[model samples]
Target: MDWEEHAARLADEVTDRVSRWREPVAAVPRHELVPRWWQQVAGEWVLRDGPCDLEAWLAAAYCDTSLVTSIGALHADHALGDEKPTGLPTSSATLPSLVVRFLRHARLTQGLDLLDLGTGAGGLAAYAAQRLGSRHVTSVDVDPYLTDAAAGRLARMGLYPQFFAMDATRAIPGTYDRIIATVALEPGRGLVPVLRALRPGGRLVTTLANTSLILTAWKAENGGAVGQVERDWAGFMKTRHSTDYTPGPDALLAHARQAEGDEVTAGRYPVLDVSAAWELRSMLEVTTPGVELHYEENGRRRTACLVHTDGSWARATAEWLAPPEVHQGGPRRLWNELERIRNRLNAEGQLPLYGSRLEITPDGVCHLSRGKWTASLGV
Candidate 1:
């Protein structure tokens, strides 16, 4: 297979958006990094083996889209052809564009020591190692299998960078000049180890869990960092402590779908898929953390559900764009909070989440403010 040609074409495509990363994008062989991946087919995760179908492999590898390499605890590399695991994606080679965006946000420079957290398929680490000599780059991931696989793949391509298998939420090995986390970090305690590993005056770029907001901050003399919520948005899998994430709220969602709620009323607005609406999702996360949102459509009817650990649950059903029938149960009215956010959006035309000033203390607490709006995340 003419992988160099494919790589060159991919470089041409991505460099149009991130011109500075042209060389690294062209040099690294993304297909080699993600030899096997999982593709969801008809609501099932079907394995895709790159070597088995070169045409499909090249098409997917060179595209500006993420490729899932692991689902739940099953890595595509080890799955049988007949196996179709049902679980969340545990690892992936993030699209080339987002990796560039992260590096650009970090303001990378030669000779700077960099830490690449959440080294899923090692695409980001490979690109960074190629741009800045491998000696200056270190990649870390919680899954030892991922680190081992990525390290071997990178070495085969004549690129070598330090790799470590450790949970990023816990203690990291050493301090660095820059840290770029491709994983979504829980705003609270998860930020502690990462901040501790950042040298004074160093920069950090990452996304908060359950939100699409990108945070870019520079470490301060006071041990905290100060910057702003970037206007750009990106979502990543939250950092995991084990081989797979704890069971999701499937049982709670099933309950929300059928139970008679404490309150039921006609909603003012039509049912909206909160997960697909990035701005609204981020705002809702800021207003009420730990809310798991699920949306479904059957023929012309649509349903949106929200469940929280606090036992608050909301379900809305509607046809097309018609106003929804809303039901709420538990101490807090979850749907009301969502409508309040929507009303603010309709009234103000935009949200204060993007471009908000951000401050991170040594303990990992985040203070975000924009105009009269202010919110704190983390313990």
Candidate 2:
């Protein structure tokens, strides 16, 4: 198959919307970067080998969608045909449109040094290296295997960018004119290094973990950064320090699934999947961090579950649009907190998350303020 044709088509699709990234989008051979990926089938991860199915491979590679390359500790390239590892996605070839969106947010200019954090499949690195010289781009990931693999793939295309195997959240090796993190950065010490790595007046574009708010800030003379939460939103995996993420709140979720809580009451609102509702999810995360959300639907019956690491859990169940039956337990009322956010949204026309003014201290604490409302995240 002529993969260039698919690449051109993808360029047309992405560049038609984001015209400035047309050159890199058209030039980078995305198929070469992601040769194998994982696709969900019947709720299980099934490996898709590109070489075996050229047509399907080209379609997925050139499509404007994320292709998971690693789940848990398993990378698609090394997975056996029958192996189906189940866990959160650790790496992926992020969708091309979103990649372009992030680069656009950086406001790239010729000769500017750029750092592409979370170099999973090297798609972003490839595009950046194509636009800016390879020498001007630096890509880093916690997985050395990822950096090595991305380097090999990029070398094949005659695009060689600096690739490092390091946890950027802990320490960034070098400073750059622009730093764009595709991975989500939690507020706290992790963010401190990122802010310190930025040269004064340099631009930083990234998302905070658990929320879809895209934060674009510039380093200031005060050692802190100043910017606004863009009116845009994007979700990304949180930065991990190891091969696989530590165990999630599965035990709490299992409890939330069935156990009768200390407080059982009729919910004022109908059951809604907080995870799928971006605005509500962001608001809840800002107001109360570290809440894990899950939603289930069976025919007309719907259920939403919220689990926190502090042993707090909320379960709400209902049929279709009917008001939900809520159960809450532990130190905090998770469901009630969600309801309060929903109530505020109903009372006010909108939530003050997006388009809010952001003030980041040198210590990496973020303060978001809009009108009379204010919220802070990080240490």
Candidate 3:
């Protein structure tokens, strides 16, 4: 079939995934949303625009997957195909599958007041407003241009909502019965404003950054929200107030490519695909901020560093390195904890990470439960 046929099929699928009221919104052409996006080619991020060929553009737009918008998290708008290894992906219209899953989790109802945080491309907002009524929906993002562009797309579709360009960390204007965040929340106190904006008996759905933790909370009678980790998956881009997320493979990849190490050793243990381990990854990111893992040499050697703004450093180098020497200077033994967690997973064949329970008290100190090992949320 042609792009139009595929778009119709995709629209039907998305409508069924969201709600009946969203059919028209989903039917709006996908090519319209992603008229132009950035893709990494030969390790360089370049702007790729369509609407030239209907078929090619439709294939990219209607498919239930994410298109890379910015590489290295920097604006790919002016990238001259000079930046290497791309950059950490800054933004994109998240895959349709993930969007569907989140909308289902959100459970939008007709005439319900909704708030879409991080209105990337405004697809989800379009989907939400189609069912919930455009007047009842509000979308906010920190990027003014992003919001403006999404607003323009919505206008083309004849779907209108109050699109505001503002930081989510501050007090939003109105109360919302449902708030869905597509951007990950900052470590602590950043989500308090989100919670504050929710009206009583409201629904809050969002995903933690860089991890698989998908959280859903509902406003209770007494002004607090309580909910557990959803038994599914979702991920959001890390929230950014600056130009881009700082310090990642961009800085260290070059260092590793020409490092003066003794030898490239074979790894002792099987490498774990960290994406499959959501809770453990979330806990690790919070407990050891700025920790990035690097695997090299036929996937044998692993060097992970935990860097802090205080200049304290902890480095762990494991290979078929025999003893797996762990260097340390910070107050905390970051590598030791990782090894412990690794051992825990090994001992039980799996950690009690997933399928655990979450309880959010009124003050937002999330208490996580896993058998007998209870832990605080904010680390």
Q: For candidate 1, which ten residues in a row score worst on lDDT?
A: 11-20
Clashes of 2: 0
Q: Which ranges of candidate 2 are over 4 A from the true structure?
A: none
lDDT of 2 by residue, 263-364 (tens): 999999999988778899998988889999899899999999999999999999999999889999999999999999999999997899999999999999
TM-score of 2: 0.98
TM-score of each: 0.98, 0.98, 0.83
**Given candidate 1, what's the lDDT at residue 110?**
88
Mind giving the per-residue lDDT tens digits that candidate 1 earns over 207-239?
Answer: 999899999999999888999999999989999
Q: Cα lDDT of all candidates, in order?
A: 0.93, 0.92, 0.67
CA-RMSD of model 3:
4.1
Between prediction 2 and prediction 3, which has the larger lDDT?
Answer: 2
What is the lDDT for 100 in model 2?
90
Candidate 3 lDDT, tens digit per residue, 185-253? 753466778878899989988766656677788887766677777777666787777436666544443
Rank ordering of all candidates by TM-score, starting from the highest: 1, 2, 3
Give the distance in Å from residue 197's predicted Cα in candidate 1 to where it truly belongs: 0.2
lDDT of model 2 at residue 8?
83
Task: Please give the range of 10 consecutive residues that has the lowest summed lDDT in model 2.
Answer: 14-23
